[model samples]
Target: MLRKKTLEILTLREGSWAIESAADDLEIAQKAALQFLGKPGVMGVRVLKESVGDIGNPAPGDILFEKLRSTGGADRIAVGEPSSLAPVCEDIEDLFHGGGRTTVNRLFRAYLDKNTVTATEVMHNAREMKRIMDFESMLPSAISKVAQMQSRSEDSPTMGERQNTLFGFADRLNKRAKQAESLDLPSLANVEINEAIHQINKKSNGEAPGYLFRVAASRELINVRNWWGKFAMSVDWAGACKSDPALANLDWFISDALSNASVLQDLLGDQDSLADALISLIEIADGVRSIDTEKAQDATSTEATAAKINGLFKASKLPESKLAVMERVCRQLQGSGALTKDGAEEPKVFREMLLRLIPGTELTGGPEMAEAITHRQSHIINKGGEGGLKAATASVLPALRDPGRKAGYLLSLIESDLGKDLLKDEIEQHLNGLFMTPESVHQIVRTGAPNKKMEKITSIFYRIQKSNLPDSRKAQLTQHLDELLASYVVDGKILDRLDDPNKPLHIRAFMLVSMCQPEMLPDGKASKLAREIIVKHLRRPNFETELVAQVPDEAKKEKILRDFHVQLHRSGFFN
Candidate 1:
């Protein structure tokens, strides 16, 4: 309803007759003035009006009575709009009749009739002012205006005042925007927010202006997000917006606000801020049923948000400066709320990311931390076939030093067939460093070698001789075997004990065969000489018949000789 004021018309006739009545417009005041025209000695009259409530500036008491005091008395009251009044009023007759000749006593008495602002009036006025502001409609424009201020010249004389004005406006707008149980404000997409902040920085040119603008922009973003949070919780936004025109922007506001996660991350790139940004993105991810299903996203919104976050995880080049933030990001990604029920695939992606990340980062313990260990084990074992065995061993040995994460790694080593067969030597080599006692080491050795000490030695020799040992392992084992073989000979000849006729022929043959192992000899002359001895002495007709005659069956004798020939061929003796 339109509010009204009382106009007091004073006529300078018949000892100053006064007429006061309620009116909202000048027409009513003019009509009231005409009432005094017919009164006796009414040469001229003046009219002034005042609202009953505090309607704000241009008070009636100031305009009318101040003019009255300046002009002594007016021939006529200038006709004008209704005026806001002070809260207090005095008696009407006292101003005209009193000797003190106070300024507002007569006017207040004539216009307000000694009334003052009551509590009910004050409440009404406050509500009325609020209705006028319509924060839901004004806040968006205020935010845009604040953004525009960033482009203004910082050297302007009024820049400080402008900053003050913008800040004050933001403060009031923030308070008013949140007045409702829920709130409504502008819908700003993440890209738009990012661009706004970027523009502010660009325009500021890396000076104080840029810093100031960023401060303002950060504040504005916070307000926008806070309002978004309240509004999103207040209603089924899509449903309400469909039926109510007033809520049409609610859906836009929600979609845009939730999508600001990337922009928020960019704005506040510190560890705490990154932590906050990650949590927000998780909440958004959890809230959204699916980008592919419930809410499709555009370049500036939800899909963009998810992309930025995932990209953060995938980025391989993390400098020392960014490690803190990355750590926080990992912590948040591992939280229970980070993934939805159907989002099992997220953990796999997270695990892959953890593999790239864990080498540089030390985990504190969480699902992602656990997943990281699993990934590290897989990385070691699955990298580049047998070619990568050394690298895999190099990788696993260090992680196995940490007792807490060691169990899974040790189990991976023990349980895998390739790990057991191919990595057996490498693993056992680390068992001492892995905190096993001598007895435990003996047990693992017994279980693994299982009275196959000779077999294991033979296998190592076979690998060394065939040059099948990885180049790295071959160099060490070959040198050790050469030194070991030298110990058995005197002056580079077979030991005299074996050469003595006191030794049995088969025993001498076996001893000579041990010395004939190509792996036990050095590569050049020694290996050629060892092969010569094996072919000349060990493969002789007498030696073969003596060795084979021990086998009972004639068929077994022939089979054993053929197997012996195959072994010689494999040892490269035939070639």
Candidate 2:
């Protein structure tokens, strides 16, 4: 009905000149046609078609009213006969813009007695504002005006696309909010709610994600408020964006997000404990999530390259004075020795930082740690002697402290432990931070004095081997077993002991047959260690042999050698 009336005014306003009794018709037209004559734009006020306001008139209603004045555009075309267009357009401009002169006078009188923004008024006003904004965005003229108002962007060529997407999102969100409001909701909403579970779940293996993780720790409902108690104890934020606040913030995010504490606390069924403490962390993680992961990953990779660049620095062709100055700079770069060193562009400077990161895996007793030192570090070319040397110097601190992260840190160099040792206090501090105690965080299997590594391994292995010598030799045999277990596989001699069961489970059980083969132990100890040589493997939940069989090899063969070894040992082949 409203649209039809608008049409009548627009047509009669444009064609009214054809009417009989021109002066008298114009007088009647002027009075009734005020509805559509205002600003000249698609959505701005103008005589549209006709007016429902017209009564007993020869033609359709004389005016179409809008709240806004006609801006020169589509609405202007609606006002073509300027003689008829001028005054009516001028006077009724407020109709399109809420002058409310037409139907508003009735409500304005009601509000005149009670002027406060009562509940009804608030709801009505909110609806009005929302509709106004939406109406403006819907109009081509208004959209163009808004686009012009925006700072001319480098991406201006794609302005239409951007505007379309942005406006489309706004439109969808507006509709969604309206639907959700009618369905019983609160003033606040989880704006980021995922619609996948509600729509695409059957077609895709996806789950709807919660929009917000409560900030403070609250023992709220069981299914909600669960992300607390997750402290990121130990992190080598060496490759982080530390300078930018976001770097530290993201570090906190990663630590807390990945922390077993967060999930475990939830699983334990009481997340109401100290969970509020995680709010800031959650917010930061949310921000990190807002960014593209690919970009974040690239930044992390850049930092890794930076660390490597430091390791590659050496005395090389640079002058000696420059070298001395570089060393001073490297020391200056360290921050309480928490990170490797500062960004080093010079070879001499970077070399000092690089040396400190040498593979320190041997610092721990675990099989994976040792293997990591071998495989991971081996690939790092020790080009930057200065950085490596400086890192070697600082290695004493962390080496003495946890030996593990230090070792983990060093493993990037593909070199053996260089006797890096942290003091007791330092060890306690570092260990506590990494969410483990000295008792739980075992010392890294490392030796700085490389010359003595062979002697110690031989001694430990021989001592272990001597204890199990078969009767009188039983002691010797026990000793031999220990020797073989600890004994660095030097000349493939350890190949004979692959099936030793009495040895420590972590040692014997973790060994790979391919590891000790003379042909495979290229570095004299071992090369290309087992596929899964990271110490964290033990921390994971366990599964059975058939499950392990699922990991197909490169040629699609599942290497069941681990199964074979376990079976051989079970069958008492060693005995």
Candidate 3:
């Protein structure tokens, strides 16, 4: 069987070789490596091709290809020990926490990247620790950078004091590294984590991760330098150890990275516009590799990409990536200006874009995303031209004269995020115009053909009940509707249909009872009044005799009476 091959590009910065990028194709990796080599600060560049090994196995792989280049004549910057503030560490655990770990991350970021290893991995591995100690300029460079930053503060310690403290911390770190090098630590690459923890005499799995961090610290200072690296690595580890109690710590790191602006920018990459950047971030979070670095292809169609995003969201392994993407998108949506190249040329584009983005935003940010969408709508309403909120509200006014159109318009607003807080009052005002007043209710009940009028009124009431309006508002409006319906029943002499002697008595009773059903009248005073009218007629002396008189056969007459009682009970009349 042929083994799979992968290519990695490494760039030398200062004295350390750091992995710049990776690709499955050698040509693409070489091209990217050459580009990095040409950059001003890069001292050297190389591409390494390695054969894939079996999963969970950490043995060395065969190198299929290698290439190297260096700026031989370029002057190298001299390394110097500076009087800088370093994190004070009393023990190996101290080195893995707070400022000490931060300092290590900054110093050996390139080194860790070059080796494709995590800070936790370095701390536990003796060989990696010795490599850091041997990296001549890393510590000196860290000292200079920290000293420069500390010097800017007004209450910084004296240079002599700072230097002595920093050097002491370095010495302690070196001593711990030597101690770890002397121990026989198990290789993390293939060890059953739980079993390893047991063998090490750790009390719980919660201690497993911490123990690993401490071990890595002993071997070498691990660098979790970039937020992206920290977040991505934590996600990977969290997925691997789902049951581990240390998962919470990994979650914290993920949350911290997602909230950082710099980290968001890193994830968004270099896009020409806000729309592109947002789409890029969304794709990344959804686990879609939208950007084609190898061929430098144009962006995939939005429809295709959206379908891919939806599929990935359903089955994605990296759940935290979606959260990070949403945070960036929320910030972008709230930003000023239009999302397209046309600017305010056509405001409908903004609406269209919003419709497309809202589903994903809602999936990720929920209420936060709704608020962001509201904010954007406010911007468009206040500044976007003829196709803005004012125009939309105005359009609804024309439909107000037609109840069916009016109900449809109001329903549309109630169903969308655009009609949220920004338009809450407007929606309420329109709903009131549709159903609240005596004049509106009268028109709704008396304007059209009897059947059409009933249909329109029912439709309006159904929508009002289901609308996003407050419960008190819905109640008040519905009560008014019920009163209107009751008035129409009385004034239109609708119940008089039951007294039509030409129709069969049972048929008249069935029609009136059906009208009392909730679907026809809902739970309100109107339905109650209809039921009262039915009960009044049913209680009349000889009413049952008159109904049974219409059915000749005794058995058939009893069955008819029984069915009528059951219908009455179900329609809430008997109750």
Each prediction's TM-score versus the true structure: 0.21, 0.22, 0.36
Candidate 1's error at 125, in angstroms?
A: 75
Give the Cα error of residue 501 in candidate 1, in Å.
9.4
* Model 3 lDDT, full chain set: 0.56
Output the worst ten-in-a-row residue range by lDDT, candidate 2: 79-88
How well is each residue in 396-469 modelled by candidate 2, as lDDT tens digits? 33433433334343322222222122222332343234323221111223444322333333333333232211
Highest lDDT, which number?
3
Error at 427, model 2, angstroms = 30
Q: List the residue pairs that clash in candidate 3.
A: 123-215, 123-216, 123-217, 124-215, 124-216, 129-219
Ranking by TM-score: 3, 2, 1
Q: How many backbone clashes does candidate 3 have?
A: 6
- Model 1: per-residue Cα lDDT at residue 284: 33
Poorly placed runs, candidate 1 (over 4 Å): 1-451, 454-478, 481-536, 539-541, 544-556
Model 2, CA-based lDDT? 0.29
Q: TM-score of model 1 relative to the true fold?
A: 0.21
Which digits, one per residue and each the tens of the lDDT, describe model 1 over residues 333-413? 434343333444443444444343333212322223333333333443455555465455556545433332333343334
Judge candidate 2 at residue 356 and give its lDDT.
36
Displacement of the residue 555 alpha carbon in candidate 3, Å: 6.8
Q: Top TM-score: which candidate number?
A: 3
Candidate 2, backbone clash total: 107
